[model samples]
Target: MGSLAPDSMVRRVYRCMCGINPGLEAPTASAKTGAFAASGVSREQLVIFLADTLRGTAEERAPLIMAMSQCGTEAAAAVTCEQVAEFLRDLISTVIQIVVHRGRLQGWQPERMGDGSLGVKLLAEQMCSELKPSDQGFCDVSSLEDFIFRVSQISLYLEMLVAEGLNVSLSGRPTPTLLPPCRETPWKELRCLLDLPTIMFLAPQLPDRYSAPWRLVFSTQLHGESFTRMVAGLSKRGPTLLLLKDTKGHVFGGFASHAWEVKPQFQGDSRCFLFSVLPRLRVYTATGYNQHFMYLNQNQQTMPNGLGMGGQHSYFGLWLDNDFGRGHSRARPKCTTYGSPQLSGDEDFTLDSMEVWAVGKPPEPEEGEEGEGKRSILDVDPEVQAMMEMAGKTLHSQGLREPEEEQEQ
Candidate 1:
């Protein structure tokens, strides 16, 4: 019958009403009320709740706007306007942050600032009115168009907001220059200009009078279905030829060969073939193949011996000659050649000559393989030949020669 403590009395009152021990309950209501009080919502909450309810009932923007405008009490309008102004300020700040980040505009330059013209002053006025700052007042200026345009380039939403505030019509046309100047040029463009496609196209052609001792180094790593498809494609495009350089014993020699092989089993409806190399892992092609190989061998570093009927050699030549000796060449079985040589257990050997062949001619017809009136596989295509001639002329005008032309003695 003794009087209960304040906490126990509150619990007893709660339990009596809800038929549950209030002592076991979480302080959810108290926490919510505390937050609401901290935010000074005691007077504004009812007004906001009523305004929200009225807003929900309205089907169109006209009714909602009219209701807000016609609110009876000054306190209601003030609260609602304050909330709207805060929302607009937050939205504007977020948009500005996004624009700055995407445009990569870190520091401001005074030179780039637009003078406070009539258009800019008007925009500032609208922004200030919407944000309702106490100390800072909005101004009107003529440079608003430039500001709106720059921000628009970064974010369409920001553009729309600015347009709405300025009461201007927006066209869908894209203005690339309107973007901040930071993204005008990208690093990738320079890289693409120097890529393989550009280099091959720009390379000079070998002169008809010059017969250079040249070797093609086609270094590649293609295998499985992809290799077969590429080989087949290359074969159909033109004659398939394999230039093999073998060094070492016949059983365990280094074999590097390039061929356009065909694979009929590809799933795609279009016939797919590829240009491939045997011992498929060690083949590459490019404009710099021969020069790179020669440089490596001359330096006595381990490299591929890519000399085609010439004196070019790889770093691995010495080791192969010593350990594997010379093996029969695929092109000329009578001529023994050393394949790619390597230093025994040397990891410093670099394969700089590994690249795809930029240019290749068809092979001459063998003596017994000729058919009546059939052109040899080695016969040059008239179109291809003409293109090569044109390319050579262009290169001559540019004072450059094909890599093969440079090797001519």
Candidate 2:
């Protein structure tokens, strides 16, 4: 999509491919595209010619080109006929629907975008002759551009997926549950604008341990108490991401490198950082900031009944109240305050929304760390575990797990 820079397209595609098959090798175009050979054009020539048309300083295009090259290399190494077909089928279907939905370009009317999207309008007209866009007699130029761009880049990605594979179809490969889409909001759209260098710098800073797929597990507004419970239950298992939206529409959050604790002392490593979403994505590290109170805690004295963060007092970071909408705010200068944008104590004191995400899988066991025993579901406090067991039996007696656990049994 034109909304996405060239580098973003390459990264998303590459990331998706890697998620689909982490071990996939890089790829190059195969000789089987006989049409090119028949036309006396080799892949190298086509690429060089395309490169000539790309307008930018060498430095500007280098990373994007490098990403594209990497995608091709991976595609060439482990592509299969089935994988290519599946990828293409899904891409075409998705691109078409996405284009038809957005249907806007540079705020221009359909009659003005020229012949690029004429086919799109004609098809829409067939479905509903009175539709606003169809009535305008103009196709959406913006959506069309997105369509073409996505198609071209994704096609290249698909080709990479099946670069040198034999044509064959097997029926038994288990399909994975698609990763849930990231939260869609104004803040997220801003995050997409980060450039390659910034992204590279932030990559390792992410609390997530995995490089490829990350899924959304909780949104305060959507999940309510379940959200708090899930965090309290699982935060210690891995890193967690917190995103908060203030009353003024400012979006920012922190990463907790260690499991959250309700204790009064600051916790977590330097890997913990704070970042802002709107205006632009800028990350602030804990290197020189106050480190004593950049921690997550939960207790009654906490301004709100739920979860809150700060150095010692509830002066910095976000505070998500238990009742959902009432007690939330991001204020003052703490670990991320020195050079970062300061939130107004008055305007941002009450937040609009809050979200939390569990980052990456639990860390793998490292050398000599195997002796440390992790707290498991059964290891919860004796009284709590006993209560849970009683509740489990009660639910079972009521047949709550009848059909649900039957399949597993």
> For residues 15-51, could you state the per-residue lDDT of candidate 1 as single tens digits?
2122111242211111221122233323233333223
- On lDDT, the leading prediction is 2
Candidate 1: C-alpha RMSD after superposition? 28.6
Query: What's each prediction's clash count?
Result: 52, 14
Candidate 2 lands at a TM-score of: 0.41
**lDDT of every predicted structure (CA atoms):** 0.25, 0.41
lDDT assessment of candidate 2: 0.41
> Candidate 1 at 40: error in angstroms?
20
Q: What's the distance in Å from true for residue 23, model 1?
A: 40
Task: Please give each candidate's TM-score.
Answer: 0.18, 0.41
